[model samples]
Target chain A: MFKRLFDWLRQPLGLIAVGIVLLTVFSLAAYGIFLTQQSSAQPIQFPHRTHVGFGIQCLYCHPGAARGPSAGIPSQAKCWGCHQQIAKTQTSALLAPLKQAVESGTPIQWVPVAMVPDFVQFNHRAHVAAGQNCEDCHGDMTLVTIAENPQVFNMGWCLDCHRKAAGEDEAKLLKLADCGTCHY
Target chain B: MNSKIPEIKLSEEQTGKWGMVIDQDICTGCQACVAACAMENNLSFVGEVDAGYGRSMHWIRIERFWEGEYPEVKMTPGQPMMCQQCGSAPCEPVCPAFATVHSQAEQLNLQVYNRCVGTRYCANNCPYQVRSFNWRDYVRPEPLPNQLNPDVTVRRMGVMEKCTFCIQRIHKAEDKAKSEGRELTDGEFTTACAQACPANAITFGRIDQPESLVSQLIRKHGHGVKHLEELGTLPSVTYFKGG
Candidate 1:
């Protein structure tokens, strides 16, 4: 009986089964490395709280959000529209780069941290005008000091919000997820 | 029909059937509509060679049907051909996969690309020849890539696409209207083609709304007919023909 048990555990088939389990474990770890390679995320860290806390609405920084598809980043000139006089003398770490860009009329190369795929069409005007607070899609941005990729922003995220809005009768016709709503 | 009088229908929400009226008299055939439509719809520019091969996917094109030739050639200006959201659409029935269909609330032919299998049947059946096929992925070189509308999808290869009447804009307008608790304005949700027309030839609005410009124009232009109406395409687009 002892010999038979040993044979069962030590057989080539048993060894092969053990190898398969080990391979799967290593592959999973390998997948994490793949994810890291694909997502070389390095956000420029635009401080939303700093702007918003200074009595700036979401639209102020992300101008044209109310009218067009894009919530266009305020031009460097727009930064000087306020920052020129307020922190004119202060050589704070963050303000120094921004101040130089504004003075030189050189645009700050604002890197896009939150990126959706090319196929998906997301409009800020539609969402903003639909009485949807910024928090609905963007989370409580007031709580976020620096902008980061907090949400997945995949189709599922979009669908869930749309589904919720569609279910609510008060949300109106535009809230419905007509395929053309996003696809076109 | 009294063109300016209101018509009431009670099956659904108090909605207007959005439509457009392009007056051929004013259209100069400058292809402004084509450029605007291309930009608005995220239509790919397949370069000059491919465009020559009829691979150019213009959602709205100003077709110039020459009446004469040489110095004596009197070029009668043409109207732009776009997806006519027909009341009785021909493209609706022929789709092997029901990729193109009408929405319940509005008289719009919605094209869902992910569902499309690229049979090209819809293109063949379409009399207006407005449907387009994506031959390959066309990416604008960097710096220019930043100019693309984030709200419009850049289509991939081997899928059929066409004008959704700037449905993206319509949705934006509608969402704006709902938020403000009101109906869409007369010219609030204009298509890019309509807006870009230098002649103000295109008027976009609900046909069902008798007071709307489209209905009024149709009434005056002898119920402005769709191209090949006998085929019963029931195109949403109505053209006002004049010199």
Candidate 2:
């Protein structure tokens, strides 16, 4: 059977058919990955590693994480507080935008990397209060040069964590699975 | 017609037995609630043409019915009609996808827009005609979208949406309460309509709490009546009849 199948595959038509199948599979996998790991370009190339390496806490820049729905982007003033002194000595191409923003009093327009759909009401404060660290959902920024959504925000992915957290209690599991919990 | 409104026992252990009491006497028919609801929920404006075709999406609508004709023409007091958040919603069971389901904790009829396949079954089954179908992808059109409340989802075309009693506010209040490690105080939070009402006609609170404004209003007025009680929808809203 192996000899016959190999002999058939040697033919031009069989080879083309196999090629098509392989191409389709590869394209589908690529498309799936593309959808899950969609990332955007920030106005300024904000290096997470540099900030995290300096031991600047995530909440220092994103103070709203523990206080509100959004883990707010740091204002230009907040950035200027450190950048004003750091830029004087460092003097790099990347620090130019930060200097311009601080000098002009204009805010840096940051393109969000990790974004859930509008339907999903994600409360950062609630998650932070639940003893979940920023890195739990948003992968270790200390490792990545550019921030990217490391995990998919799909329902199954969310349920996997929620279900595990809820444990064997059916009621707790149902509460986690409840559409109103996130959607409403 | 049965003419009987089924009594619902408020569950004590539940987070809240949410209820609303609308004072028809005080309602000025200003349509503030309607506008507030639309803005708060990110309801799509269907424009004049679609609205003419009865495709307008107003979660809380002022329903004005004329009783008399000519010189004696008397328009009955305008009643704000939104989702009653029925105790036994007709829309719930008909949804094949289970998109519309009752939230036992809040006593709310939740319409999960993501799960909705726009079957229109839930809309048809709703006797109050509160659920509005998005006939087309209604354009937000530039600066108008800036006003949309971030908490609520802007429902897309082919999704059935209705009044959720401002479930977003309820969630926020609940979250705030939970973080503070205390129960939500009455009047600490309310629906957009109730909050925006110039006349203060709408009272939303825990009906289970005897001291709650909604509960007090219902009791003081000798149990406000539900609209179309004969239908046995057992709506959570109690409309106080004006003399």
Candidate 3:
């Protein structure tokens, strides 16, 4: 009677255990996909609308975009370069917080919008020279109000642009997966 | 995986292969290339102690290969050397995980640090002794983080990193070319070393292109030899002796 009970428990119960493991894995995968779709988080809602409508080009804020590896962020001094002469005091609620940071010689702690992983090399100089419009990679900022995560700066996205530019020839030109192309 | 498959396309039969001609005569050994490479590739530098322990990470190192006796002896300047990205690479097969592979384009060896488990099998097999290991995490001080190139990834600790021939810059240039709907012209995309060379000693371009500046330099300078030729590494980088 004990042997009969043991056999029954092993068959059905063991099947249930396997099913549980499979379910857990699928649930985890689904969760990861859902989280990824939520997109990257942003700190401040620095709208490009107010700035661009004022006829300010991207280089006004990111001064180093054309010449250097980095597109320099606007320091408090940079903000005051215009704001001091125009709006001496905080007129809008948004500019209020930054007013002190600007007037007191402190800087706005702006968070990075596009953060590339370590081991990858990205240069604005070469990109600018290659005739890539800022909008191509950064997306259509003209239509953007808040700095939303418009660009999906993934390896596939980078590779797609490279494959299109360098030609399909893997020997003469580079592809995205070419370890040297990205890692080194 | 078919290990022998070409990673990028380039005709093997091309004569006067486009190659950098490092003029030791003009090489100041300023290490601009070294710094440019570090910032461009997200290479993390270990402190002095770690560096003394052989963990200072530098992909392209300015190796001062000296000769002659003391007193009156002169330090014959040397060029910075990195991965040759050989046609037949020693580091390629020795990698247990196949982290480093050849680019089908210019025959550049691409070192994928993410896939590397840090067995350092490639470092042991490399004849140039160019591969560097990261002993610790490095941080760019405060606002200086803004100085980092957005194109490159910052490497973490305990990973093996090496020269990628600045393929990221190459890819960026290619992207621009595609957007413009044109072929990548010679001198359009250059490695940082080539660009920062004050003496114009370093030349970079598509090796497959017959009329490229690299090909022209190889023609002008008769001595274009690989670092360790007898080892059969088939290094894409060619060395030319100075006057």
Candidate 4:
């Protein structure tokens, strides 16, 4: 059957059909890759600069970061606590989503820009306890509107910093370098 | 994950950091450890058909043997078996992908699921027959999926997994201890199996610390034997075969 298909593909009409199928498949795959590379769509264009300008800490919104594995996305109520007090929140175009979400008691879906692979058991508390600042991995939040990944969160990138941090401490280096420390 | 930490030779004097002392005499073979292990590790349950073919994904299993002739047969004590976390693990050297490697810091063999390409080399090499491979991504329909532990990575198909000595709990306890500005106390934490055991058959803790419960148990009962010790695997689990 495959040989017959191959023979058919040698003909002009079949060759065109084969080219079309191959082109379609390649383009579809390329498009899929392109989609993954694109940043996820968020409900609101949250201005991190505005929040940071007011000296609001990252821990205020994502309090779970200090306490546990997940640096949790703050609830809609948390957002409305400040936004409802702000006068511009009533009329600002960007704040419209927040206003609607608050009025409807629905949550604004914020896209998590920074995520490590599932296999990596990243604990924010451990990193926070180690005195790692939020900006160390998540770039300058004050410089961007929506959060953006400054660098690829890969093993090499992580190890580079871990190695540098573990400098002279033998136990610390051993613990930090151990795969079970994070991978398990 | 191989670390830069110097590999310690498993001499007769060198006790591992984490160790278990399982009293087989008290073990009921009730399979609570097996159930707890499955629940704690997010292990997929292969149905009866697959399980019958020896494809069940139990991280810890209960083993038993019959003593004497059939007419006067008596069932021996239930023995719970799991990854021995050998200091000189037979599984480690056989893994081409380095997925099943010894954690130098933890002094336990780690099976990195993401690193495993399902070659089953490490599983084949394991002396204890503890390694369970993911033949397929077993389904847990509906609400069953919601019970999955968030701390553990829910592995998909084509990955080999085994008992991790409940490393998630270890990390959680360690993190808690660290935040509290103190060292981990004995009985502060334990593996799911130890916690779930009704008869208190399993005791797990720092064997390196002589004062720990596991070490004390070992010292109290000096007759405990490690299975397949002659192979020089330096298995961390000590079994006390009850009379």
> DockQ order of candidates, best first?
4, 2, 1, 3
Ranking by lDDT: 4, 2, 1, 3
TM-scores of the candidates in the order shown: 0.69, 0.85, 0.61, 0.88
Residues A153-176, model 4: lDDT tens digits = 998888888998899998988888
Best by DockQ: 4
Which of the two, 2 or 4, has more DockQ?
Answer: 4
> Which tens-of-lDDT digit does each residue in B115-212 have in candidate 2?
99999999898999999998899888899888988999988989999998898898899989998999999999999999899999999999878888
Candidate 3, residues B11-47, lDDT tens digits: the string is 2333223345577677888988888777776666576
Itemize residue pairs with steric clashes in candidate 4.
none
lDDT of each: 0.74, 0.85, 0.72, 0.89
lDDT per residue for candidate 1 within B4-87, as digits (tens), equals 744432222213377778888888888888888877776777999888889988888877776766878787767788888766
Docking class of 3: acceptable
Q: What is model 4's DockQ versus the real complex?
A: 0.59
- Show the lowest summed lDDT stretch of 10 residues, model 1 chain B: B7-16
Task: Write candidate 1's Cα lDDT for A106-181 as tens digits.
Answer: 7788767566666666777777776787666666677675565556797777877777767756334453656666
Show where candidate 3 strays beyond 4 Å.
Answer: A1-184, B1-18, B69-72
TM-scores computed on chain B for all candidates: 0.87, 0.91, 0.87, 0.94
Q: Weakest 10 consecutive residues, lDDT, candidate 2 chain B?
A: B7-16
Q: Which stretches of candidate 1 lie over 4 Å from their true place?
A: A1-108, A125-136, A139-150, A168-175, B1-16, B25-30, B64-79, B96-98, B114-117, B139-151, B175-182, B196-200
Q: Chain A of model 4, TM-score against the native? A: 0.76
Better of 1 and 3 by lDDT: 1
lDDT of 4 by residue, B156-175 (tens): 89999999999999999999
Cα error, residue B108 of model 3, in Å, equals 1.3
